[model samples]
Target: MNELPSIEQIASCVSGYDPNALPVAQAQEFIARFVTPVAAVESIALRATLGRVLAADVVSPIDVPAHDNSAMDGFALRGADLAAEGDTRLRVVGTGLAGQQFDGAAPARGECVRIMTGAVMPPGLDTVVPQEFTRSDGDVVVIPAGAVRTGDNRRLAGEDLARGEAALTAGRLIRPADLGLAASLGRAELPVRRRLRVAFFSTGDELRSIGEPLDAGCVYDSNRYTIHGMLARLGVDAIDMGVVRDDPAALEAAFRAAADCADAVITSGGVSVGEADYTKQTMAKLGEVAFWRIAMRPGRPMAIGRIHAAGPGSKAAVLFGLPGNPVAVMVTFYAFVRDALLRMAGAAPEPLPMLSARSAEAIRKKPGRTEYQRGRVVRGADGDWHVSLTGAQGSGILRSMSQANGLVVLRHEQGSVAAGERVDVMPFDGLV
Candidate 1:
C-alpha cells in the first residue's frame, strides 16, 4: 500500500493558504489528494451489482448480435436490385424470423427475402427496405427506386460491441444500464469493490434523538437522520452512533470507537468558533483535526483530517466535522463529504455538471463567500428554465431544503444577481 501524504505537505503544495477564506475548489483539491480509496474486491452476482464500484475492466467475449440482422421488419434485397428512376419489383423467395435462418441458396438478382426485426440477414443480402415501403402481390414485392441506400436498416455483426473490446472500465459505479450491458455480455457476476463503511453521529448537549420527550430547552436531533439518508443514497455501510453529548470523555470515546470500525467519520456539530461545546476539544485530543472558517455561507465552519485509534491493530479514519445547522450539514455533505466518500469507496472521480437557468427574481449576494440557496426550478411561459428561491434561505430552515429540487450556487467573487440573469444550478435528483 502507498502511504498517504500528510495534510501539511498538501497545504505546502498550495500556492497560498488562507485559513479563514478558503476557496471551494482549493479545499476540494486538498481533500481529494488526502483521501485514499479502499483496496478490497469481491465478486457478486450481476443482479446485486447496482451502485457497486467495478473493480476490473470487463472485455467482451464475443461480438454483440453475432450476425448481420435486419433492424426492422423489411425486405432484405440486393442494393443493385434498386432500379434507377423507377419502381423495382422482385419475388419474395423465403421468410426469415429471429433465431431462424432462410433455408435456401442466396437470392437471385430478381429475388428478395422477407425478414423480421432482429432476424439474421439472408446470404448475399446487404440492405433492407421497410415492409411498409413495399407493396406485395402474390409473393412479389415492389419497392420505390430511391427508397433505401446500401446497408440501410441493417445491423452488422459486432456493431454494438466487438469481441475482445473493453465493455466497462474499472472504478465505475454500476448503474441500471451498466447491469444490462454486463448481462448482454453473458456475465453472471462482476468484480466490485467492497462497500465503504462510514460511521456518523451528532454532537450537541441540546440535541435529542427521535422518540425522546421534548425538553424545555432542547430540540430533536434531525442531523443524524438526514446524514443517515444521505449516506444510504451513496451506498455506503453506515454506522449511526446516535447523539454524543457535549462531554469531553463521551465525545472522545465516540471518536475512538468510530475510527476503530469505520473507514471515515462524520459529525454534524461542534466545529464552529465561539461555540460553547467540547466536541472540538475532544476531537483535537483524539486526532489531528483542523477547524476552518471556509468562505461559504450556510456552511462556513468545517473540520477535516484523520483520527487514530489507540493500541495495536487499531485503524485510523478520516474525519469530517460539519456545521450544526440542518441545511448547513446537507450543503457541506453534498459539496465535500459526498465526493470524499465516493473516492474512499474506490469509485472514480465523477464531477457533477452545473446547469444554467434564468433567475425568476433578484438575489442578494455578497462578493467574498460561496452561497447555496434552495431553489425550485420550473419552465416559464417563455419556454425557458427559470429558478426561484424555495422560501427562507436560513441554514436552519430545513423546510426550504425539503421543498427545493436544486440549489442556486453563487460562487465566490460574484456580486448580487439581477432578475432574469443566468445562474448555475445543482440538481438534487438525476445523474450524479
Candidate 2:
C-alpha cells in the first residue's frame, strides 16, 4: 500500500467536517474520497472471472458473425423483384444450410434460394422473407406485399460486434453476460484485479463462539456469521479471526495480526464510549484513525481510518470499527463497509437503488438522523407496493432483520411519516 494522507487532513477537505455529528451522506462521501483501490492485475481463465473486476479493456479479435448471414429460415431474394402492392411469386432454385456454402449458381431475377437461420447469404441476394409468412407450392414461394422488406431477416457482418472493437471496458465488474461476450470474441482468459482480502472479528468479553460452553452473562456471537455472509456476497476473500476478548493486550494483538495479513480489518464493538473503549484506544495508538458518531439510527459510532503493524516491511490496512449490536453490525456494513471494499477492489462502486413505496402505518423519527426500518413490501389489491414493519425497530433484533425483505430508508432532515405516505426502500433480494 502507498502512503496516504493523515486522517485529520482528509477530514479537513470534507464540507462541515464534524466527527461528532456527521451526516450519513457526508460520511459516505468522505470514505469514497479517501479510499484507494488496488492496482495489481492477473490473467485468469474465463470461467473463473465471474464477479471479478476487469483490469484492462477486452478488444474483439474478430467480427462476431464473420460474414453476412440469414437471421431466419426463409427464401433469400432481391428487394426490387417484389411487386408494388400485391404478392410476388418466385422460384426456389437451391438450399443454403448453416455452415455449408451454396454450390449452385447464384439466384438471378425472379429466382430465390431457400435459406435457414445462421446460413450464409448467397451471392446477389440481400433480403429474406420468412417461410411461415409465405405460401409454398413445389419449387415456388409467394411473398406477400408489405410482409417482406429489404434487409429484413438479414444479419450483416460485424452486426453484433466489429473486429478490433472494445467488448468490455476496464474497471467493470464482470458478470455472466460479459463472460459470453468475451467468449464470442475468442478470449480464453481475462485480465482482472486481484481479489481483496478482508479480515474481520468481533470484540466483547461476553461474546463466545458456537460450540463453546454458554457461561453466565455470555451470548453466542452472531455478528461474525452475518459479516462473513455479507463479505461472501460481495466476492471478497474473507478471513474470520473469531472473537477477541476485551483485554488490552489481546485486542492489540488481534488488530496487529489482522493488519499484517489483510488489506482491511473490521472489528465490531469497543467503538462506542464507556466500558468498551479498549479497542478504540488500541486502534488510535497503532494508526491515524478517526472515531465518528454518524447521525444515523441503529448504527451511530464508527471508527474509520488506516492501521499499520509495528515491524519492518509493514503495510497499512484500512480499518472499520463498527457498533456492538447484532442488527447494527449488518446495517453499518451495508451503509458503509460494502462500498469501501468495492472501491478497494478496483471496481466501479454503485450504490444500491432505493424504490418508492407506501408506508402501512405512521412511524416516529427525528429530523436530524436517518433510520432504516426492516419492512415487508407486497403488492396490494390495488397493484401498488405497500410496506409494513417487521416488528420492533431495536438495534439488537436480528430476527426482524431476517424476516424483512427490504429496508425502508428514512432520510436525514425529515421528521415523522404518516400512513399511506410515499417513502424510499432498499431491497435485499440479491444483496443477502
Candidate 3:
C-alpha cells in the first residue's frame, strides 16, 4: 500500500480546480492525478488475457518467419532468369509444398521449382512469379517479360518481426488480435496486470433490486446492471452490492465493506444537491471525498476521492459517486469512470475513438457545458456519416440510450449546430 496524496493536494495542483461547475476535462485530469495503478501482476493463459492489461513488454524470442519463405503459390527462380523483353522458359525440377521444403537437387541455370505459399524459399531462388502468370508447356514454366522483379512476392527471414524486437508493449489492452500476436511468438502465457475488484451499488430509498416487489413511488435499480456490464467490458471484477436505502448505518457499513474488499467503489444516485439521501454524509465520514457539479449534460453530479475501511492501516478504495438517472450513470461512466478505472487496472491511457459525422437535424447546445446526446448514426445520400437524435433524451430515459449507437458529442466552447454541419461522435461499435 502506497501513501496517496490527499484529494486537497491533488486539487490544489490543478490550475482552476473548482468543485462547482468544473469542466469535464478538468475533472478527468483531477481524477487521473489522484488515482494510481494497482501494482500486482499475474501470468495467465493467452485465452484468458482478453481485455487484460500487459504488465511488461513482450520481445520476440525468434524471427517471425524463421527463414526465407514464399508469400505466394508460384514458380521460384532467380530474377536474372526473368527476361526484360520476351518470355523466358525454364525446366521444373521439383515441387515444394508449405511446411515441406524442396529437398531435391537445386535447379540448374535455366530451371525453376514450383512452390506454394508458406514454403521455405529454396537455395538460389530469389523471386516468385504467381503461378497464374506463367504458362505451363510440358515440364517447363514460361514467365512473361514484366511479371515480376527481384524479391517480388518473397517473405524474407524476420521480415515481419525480428528476433529480440519488442512485439507487444507494456500497458497494452489485450484484444483478440493481440492474443494471436503473442501466440505467433510462441507465448502460451502472458504477464498481465491483475484485474481490479470493484464494488458498486445504488443509493436511494426508493430504489429496489431486481426481483424485489416495487412499492409505490419506487423503481428497480438498473444502474447496478449497467455498472456490472461496463465493468465486465473493462475486465474488472465487479461486485454488485445491491441498493442501500437512506439509512446512515447501512450506508456507512456498505461503504466500509466495499472499500475493504475492492480497489474502487461506485455508487449511482444520491450524489446530487439537496437529496435527502445519507450517501453523501456517509462518504465524508469514512474518508476524503469531494462533490462536483461537472459542466456536462446527461450527467453532471459527480463525487471522486478515496474512502478507507475501518481499522488502522486499512486499504483505501478509489470512490466514484455518480448521478442517479439511468442515462446519466452511463454517460458519466464513459466520460469519467472509464478512464479512471483503466488507469487503476494498469491499462494504457487510450481515448475512445471519436469520428466526425454530419448532423441530420439542428441541435441546440450551450457553450460552457458539454452535452452528450443519444444519436443513431447512418450513412447519408452524400456517402458521409450523419447522426440524428434518439427521441426523448431525458437522463432518466434509459430507452433513449438503448436506441442509440453513439453519443453525439457537442463539445465545450461549441454552440448550436445546424443541419449538415460536421460534429464529433463517440461511437459504441467496438467499445465491447
Candidate 4:
C-alpha cells in the first residue's frame, strides 16, 4: 500500500502556491478542485421554488400581459380627438376591468371608452384620459384639459417580454420577484436543481448530542447543528451523521456511511496531527488526504480529502475536516464548502459581493497570514461607509460572529491598516 502524504508534502505538490493567498482566491481554487456538477431534476411549484438554482433557462411561452391593456384608471380615446382639447366630450361606449375583456369595437369619432387599471383597451382606442383629468356626466366623459397621444397609457402586448424569449437564464438563483415573473409567463411549475445531499458530523469523545445528559468535560455538539442550519439557508438537504467518538473504527464506520449516501461529508475536528486524532489514521486507511493547513488565521488546520471506495462497488465522497473551534469551523465552511456545494448544484459561481469602506480603527496582522476580522459597517448620513471591529478575534469566540454584519478582509502581504485606509468589506447576511 502507498503511504499517505504529510500535510506539507501534499501542499508542496501544488508548485508556486502561496499559503498566504486571500480567502477569495483560495476559495475559488478550492471549489474548482473538489466539487463536480450533478445531473438532477425536480418538479416544483412556483411558490416553493424561490432560492432554488434553475436547471434550465426559463422561456416565456406567452407574451407578458398577453394583450393591450390600460396602464392606469382612465378613459381610452383616439389621440386625434384631443388635437385641440377644449372639453372634448365623448360618449362612454363601455367599461373595462382587469381580467374582463371589452368585446365591442371602439367608440366612433368624438367618442371614448372608460377603462380601469389593468383593463384591456377596447379595439381601435389608442389613448387614455385619466379619470382625474376628465369628468363623467351620465353617459358621457368630458376631457377638460389633459392631452395624450396615440399609444399613451396603453401597455402593448409583449412589451415586458416577448413570446419564446429567454426570460431567465440557467444557473440563476430564483428570488421572490423572479417567482412573480414566472407567474406572469403562466408557469405553474419550474425546473430546478435537486437539493444537494450533504452528510456532516462532529467528531470528538468529549462532545455530546443536544438534549442528552452532559458528563464532565463534555460539551453539546453545537457545530453539527450550526453547519446544518447554514446548509439549510443554502437550500441543501443535509444529513446529520451524529457524533463520532475518537475511536478509529467508529470514525471509519461513520465516514463509510456518509460516503455511501451523501455527495460530500463534512466533519468538525480530528484532522489535526495529534495522538487523539483518529480522523487522520482512518483517512489513511480508507482514502487519501489532498491538502491541509491553509495558512489563514483562525482556520489554519483545515483539511480537504477524498474517501476512496470502501469496497468494489463503493464510490468516492469529498470530505472537509474543519477546525474544532466554533468560529473557525463556521468560517472554514463558508470559505470552502459553501461554494463547492453551490457548484455541485449547478449554481452560477459568483464572487461574494464586496464593498469598500474606511476603517474606523487601525488593524494589525502578521505579514504571513490572511485574516478575516468580524466587523460592523454603517453608512453615515454623508453616504460614506465606515467599519469597526466587533470585539476579540479569537477563533472560539462565536459571539463576535453574531455581532458582526460584515468581514473586514486583510490581504496576506498588507501590513497594519491606518484608521482611514480603504478596506474590503463583505456582508455576512447574503453569504451562504
**Ordered list by TM-score, greatest first:** 1, 3, 2, 4
- In terms of lDDT, the poorest run of 10 residues in model 4 is 1-10
Residue pairs in candidate 3 whose N, alpha carbon or C atoms collide under 3 angstroms: none
Please list the C-alpha lDDT of all candidates, in the order they appear.
Answer: 0.90, 0.91, 0.91, 0.80
lDDT tens readout by residue for model 2, 16-111: 989999999989988988788887899999999999999999988898789889999999999889889999899999999999988899888999
Give model 2 RMSD, 1 decimal.
1.7
- TM-score, prediction 1: 0.97
**Candidate 2: pairs in clash:** none
Taking the tens digit of each residue's C-alpha lDDT, what string does model 3 give over 231-298? 98888999999888889999999999999999999999888999887889989888889999999998
Instruction: Please give the distance, in angstroms, between residue 34's alpha carbon in candidate 4 and its true position after superposition.
Output: 2.9
RMSD of 4: 4.4
Point out where model 3 deviates above 4 Å.
none
| Clashes within 3 Å, all models in order | 0, 0, 0, 0
lDDT, candidate 4, 236-290, per-residue tens: 7899989999897898899899988887888898866554778778866777554
Name every residue pair that clashes in candidate 4: none
